[model samples]
Target: MSPLDQLFSNYLPVFLGTGIGAILVISALVGSRLLAPYSEERNKGTTYECGMLPIRRASTNVGMRFYLYAILFIVFDVEAVFIFPWALSYLAVGPQAYWEMVVFVGILAVGLAYAWKKGALRWQ
Candidate 1:
């Protein structure tokens, strides 16, 4: 086969799949827009909370500590995720991988220590 034919053959499925996926997404969006209910009442756009009438502005002051805790949680959660795959493949990948993971964990521990020292881990 010619190079052009070979290239077309290799990428035909990818192009077809992308076109199909796009069509599906566009159809779903159009269907929803056409079939979903629409209302223009003032109450329809108001802030809703637990089926109760909102007494105050919806936006409120959130403490910086909440963000700090969330970031720390995400960091440690991702570390655990990485550790699981490494743990499963440790023996096959040998001592180099083990030492690499040890170094990774050591870095995370140092970060945790630093955060502790800076009072980022304090609850109150």
Candidate 2:
């Protein structure tokens, strides 16, 4: 077979799949637009807050400390997740896996130390 024919044969399935996916998405969107209900009530566009009328605008300032605490929590949470599986299987894997996990925990410890020194752990 010619190179052009071979290339077309290899890509034919991909092209067909993409075309079919696009058609399906477009048809779904068009069908939703045609069949969905339309509303013009005054309260329809108002802000909703737990079934109660919103008392104020939603936008507000959030302290950077909140984000820092969230990041630290996520980091340690992931560390725990990794450590659990390794703790269960480390005996079978031997000393190399143990040392690798030690290094991983060491890196995380250094990060925690740096964050502590920078006062990221401080609440006030």
Candidate 3:
């Protein structure tokens, strides 16, 4: 009947669930260590890198064009994603939402234009 009792009842489930999950995870990990193979090779030169040569110094200026294009692609891809949700709800959301999208897209267009002007797109 009391506010304190109601709040405690609501929060008690979350606290109990978290404590149970933690205990189970710790027990499973300890059990696994006992049952699993343990290896200690201090020199780990063969750490996974897509089966490429384990020793190679990368030249820093190999090609920034890839990174540049990736960034631009993500930027416009995000713009398209935003447009989709807005377009889907446009009829239900009315013209105010549409106007908001126009403002959002205008900002994106300006940014893309600035990048273009700054020669970020030039691969040379």
Candidate achieving the largest lDDT: 2
Model 2, 27-85: lDDT tens per residue? 99999999998879998897877789887777787888999999999999999999999
Q: Which model, 1 or 3, shows the larger lDDT?
A: 1
Sorted on lDDT, best first, the list reads 2, 1, 3
How many clashes does each candidate structure show, in the order listed? 0, 0, 0
The lDDT per prediction is 0.93, 0.95, 0.86
TM-score of 1: 0.54
Question: What C-alpha lDDT does candidate 2 achieve relative to the native structure?
Answer: 0.95
- CA lDDT, candidate 3, residue 39: 86
In model 3, which regions exceed 4 Å deviation?
1-61
Please tell me which predicted candidate would have the highest TM-score against the true structure: 1
Per-residue lDDT, model 1, residue 3, is 100
Off by over 4 Å in 1: 1-54
**Best first by TM-score, ranked:** 1, 2, 3
Question: Where does candidate 3 clash, by residue pair?
Answer: none
lDDT of 1 at 9: 98
Q: How far is 89's C-alpha from truth in model 1 (Å)?
A: 0.4
